[model samples]
Target: MMYTQEQNREVEKVMKAFADYIRDTQHFDLLWSDKVGYVFLDGISEEHDDFCMAPIILRDGETLCEEIIYHIACDVMEEKGKSHDLRLCGPVEREEIQKRLLPYLRQLPEYEHLVEGLFEK
Candidate 1:
């Protein structure tokens, strides 16, 4: 089903927040595709063909999108910081994201479930 207006607004919120975060810290621009639930044309990674925020946007809802944004923050831009790290080298792996960065991000409101169901050991 197509996203309702309210849900679309949530997507915009998440996209804007993420774009702003990218601009402020990375000094670059981000392009997002709602149809595909991925961010591309990032001015950061020369090696970066592209990056996908996990779980898809419309299908996954904004809460998870927010978590995915934080996931990109911690994995792609922050910790890895333009590297060949496995996290950025390919499509985001939920387990890898949860394992490598969730503990640090879990305190943040949006990332509280960064590992919830997926990372249980």
Candidate 2:
């Protein structure tokens, strides 16, 4: 769904806040996707924008495309923790945990209302 101007502003605020938090605490740089639910971390070289959001990458087609595109803040705490540790040390696992955290991050209270307001049908 296309976002209204007010919704866009709210989402931008949330994105900026979340991005700042990630940068400050986790030190991972975030790049947002034009698609609603996708954001990528810097230094991870991936050609396609589709793979940018880790959780969406891990999801099955329908769920990934539908759920992630709407709610992008569900797993902030857990993803942030993992990303922070990964940034400080190194790659701990072969699989990207951040992608798996996308849905959860979108579920966050701070973001849930925004998603509902902006994307809910």
Task: Indicate which candidate wins on TM-score.
Answer: 1
**C-alpha RMSD between model 2 and the true structure:** 11.8
Query: Cα-based RMSD of the predictions, in order?
Result: 8.0, 11.8
Clashes of 2: 11
Candidate 2 stretches greater than 4 Å from native: 25-28, 34-121
CA error at residue 32 for candidate 1, angstroms: 5.9
Model 2, residue 9: what's the lDDT? 61
**Decoy 2 TM-score against native:** 0.27
- Model 2 over residues 25-60: C-alpha lDDT tens digits? 322244445665334343333443333334322112
Model 2's alpha-carbon lDDT is: 0.37
Best prediction by lDDT? 1
Q: Which 10 successive residues of model 2 have the least lDDT summed?
A: 56-65
